[model samples]
Target: MSAWLRRGTAATYAATLGVLLLGAPAAAAAPSAPAPTGAAAARKAAAPPASVDARLFLYNEHGQAAVAPGDTVTFVMSTAGYPENVPQHKTVVLELPEGVTFRSATNQHASGPCVPDAAGRKVTCTTQDPVDQLPATNGAWWVTTDFSDELPLGEYVTAKATLTTEIPDPEQDNNVSSWDVFVATTGDMSVAISAPPGPWKVGDKFDATFKVHNFGPYRAPFSLSSGINPVSGLRYSGWPEGCGFDPGEMQCTFGVLEAGKTFEFTMRFEVTEYDADGISLTPTIYPGNQDTNAANDKASYRAKIIKPSASPSPSPTGGQAGGEPTLPITGAPAVPLAAAGLSLLAAGAGALLLARRRRTS
Candidate 1:
């Protein structure tokens, strides 16, 4: 344990520890070194521009028959834009045709430019006043207007409305887009039949009427046919005197009807004596070669014939009055045995009394 030897050992250990710590830091720094070039930053900045497409669509609340000369039709506008950052709401101008008179306009939850004509006949709109502006949330824009009383009938009229979308383009000015709306004239034709209850008794006759209406723009050709419901015991009277089917039989007839006009056909039917139960009286429309769609093709009227409970003849023994006889009576003579025997006894007594008188004399 010499002091000089101990001091030399301590100096050597301290020097070793310092060398180990310095070497450890150099090794760590070599593996964790930062790159001089920023490749990720350059890739993000040089990315390609995104593609954008915008579309607008208009729909009428009423389908095929939505438009009428004096009816109000609603037009709904919607838009779809790509590149999620695009702005949806903007100024919209609706140019209507002479026939379509704008009554009033409104926008729910929108702010900007809106102006209406002095007579409230035409509506000029902007972001501040959208004739029919949709919310900022992309979707439907709707407005309804009534047809002016001056709108003429019997003709198809078309009107147009325009919707403008302001798409924000910070890099460019005047970034407005527009869509078109179409309004069409409306009309329809329909027919219905009204008939009385059937199952009429034999020799009974009845009348029925078929009413046809023009609910649409133009005149339509219609046909009517009347037939007996075999199950109803009812039959159509053969060709009413002045009235006859187009083909000469009462089976079918044709006629022309003008818009808003009503036409009726009266038919008569007779109930036959031999007609069976469950027979029906029916009338049907035969729209032959008509341009009307199948949806309006034909309508039917029906009545049934039920057997009557009373009859002239009494029921045969053990058989129902209305049903065929179970047993039939045959030709046979009737005899009375009690009268024959009484006559025979009288004759015998008279003969015996005569014999007794002769013997007594």
Candidate 2:
């Protein structure tokens, strides 16, 4: 079995609290208070006694909860939510699924030895000691199993585990847990990214579209995982739901995509500071199912960052390059203020001379 297709895991926590009245109410001695009503008394009498809560779960190395044939998997059975200083009648039972052979089991938290049946199909671990030590109510066991190489592809199998106590549990739903494992098949999964064209300048915001395409012979079930790298100069401004993010990386998971189908989403980014001449948004994809093509698994979109250009020095004469010097007019004339004033003064002098000549005539 290939490493990527070998393992997937599912884990969940369960807690059930049974309240016990260890002491009487402060007002119980008050004679003036009325006694309990008929229904209240009947209900109180019918209530069960307090007991320790126990939960069971099966876990694997990876979180996807899947497995492939011929793969050896180690499952961890964990017990939790057992109150302190309580008597423990703890017993854990594990049953193997078809086509899976049990190898071994070990106790981690309890004092009991794990005993497997003659055929290795079932195992039991138990402890009779009361939980005297603080936090001693927990139990954990490691169990190993191997999938027969003859197991067919795309087969879904389930392994069962249960935790039990001598006393009845307040919540029975969590006492047993089942881990679902799937035999994955290869589906050619690939990703492509499209970003707004740049010269992207600082303070500019844009959306990048990511499309995940499954060029398949099989459906990519249980979704897919993608890593969108945040290159220099680009800061994440917005993210779609169903994704997890960290500095410099964004992780997203999409639901099942059928063969030849594509899943599309968008992420908003802003150009904050430029660390290089360009930024490349490269998103790589890993399918929950097996994938054979590595070449098309990732795609990149490159954008050139536009650096701040130096402000042009004030033209020596306050005029733009290759253009004539612009003159400021005092009023409506298209001439310099000084030149217009001089012309007005000369015209006034000529008018005065003409008046003198007319008087002489």
Candidate 3:
């Protein structure tokens, strides 16, 4: 063979051997699986964790009592844990009602002067110490907090607060579970009258004072008037100050009375005739926008007056000298048999005497 042909044959054989060796290894090795997508990984990470739910309880220490405007009120918070292995530690926050100011907090878990938020809006009250170890079944803790004198006098003012627990998991912290509590304020009123001494004589002029008080949550408007039972001998002479009156109609208007406030007015009456019977003074209260007749029907108080006794009248002649000892007899007419028999006997004797004298003549 020629040298060039031998060199070509040798080079071709070497190239063929190199291709076989590279292809055999590539075929033996398999392609690795693609990495999982971010979404799939996240889903796996988000798989629900094994956890226990926590619980809490809240109550009003004031017995859900009512409070008037400008009155400070306190509420009590009670908390507890549920389930065996759950240790609970939580933070609490409260949103006070309008017209109320924060006063003080007791049984605080943490220390430092706590106050309302910068806007003077929300209260930033929180528990200082952690609820270390909770009872297996049920355990509890409580605290009382007071509000400042900022309440407006009114009905149905609401006070509210919330309790929350932070749940811890390996993946995340501060998972919160919460509950809420609420309470309201109180309202009441008292009414009375101041008047002249009794045993009122005929034609005597007198005046009476009526006082109204607000003992409850807010202020209320009222109407005042007087009534007389003709039989009671009690009559109203002039309507109360600032009041308009007709013979049988009395009407007066009183504005609002703030909680813990009072108002008074005067009324006049003249005793026209002597009243042997007793009398009664009735004073009533009416809410705003109510009719006078309807208001009088809601009388809050009724007082009575008794007239002094009068001298006794003399007995008639031929009757009992004194009022006592006089007995009343009631029956049919009666005849006396003995008196009739005596009259008949006398008439017969007179006839006999006249006949005897005639015979003698």
Write the residue-wise lDDT of candidate 2 on 243-286 in tens digits. 78666667776556778888888878788876554767767887
TM-scores for all predictions: 0.33, 0.62, 0.30
Candidate 3 per-residue C-alpha lDDT over 34-138 given as tens digits, one digit per residue, 9 for 90 to 100: 776664444344533254344434445554344444445554444443333344445445555565556555433332224566544345443334233222112
The models' CA-based lDDT, in order, is 0.52, 0.69, 0.51
How do all the candidates rank in terms of lDDT, highest first?
2, 1, 3
Stretches of candidate 1 exceeding 4 Å from the true structure = 1-52, 107-114, 117-134, 168-361
Between prediction 1 and prediction 2, the one with superior TM-score is 2
Tens-digit lDDT string for candidate 1 (320-346): 678866766455533456677789999
* Worst-scoring 10-residue span by lDDT in model 2: 10-19
Shift in Å, residue 57, candidate 1: 2.1
User: Which candidate should be chosen as best, given lDDT against the real structure?
Assistant: 2
What lDDT would candidate 2 get against the real structure? 0.69
Clashes found in each candidate (C-alpha, N, C closer than 3 A): 23, 4, 11
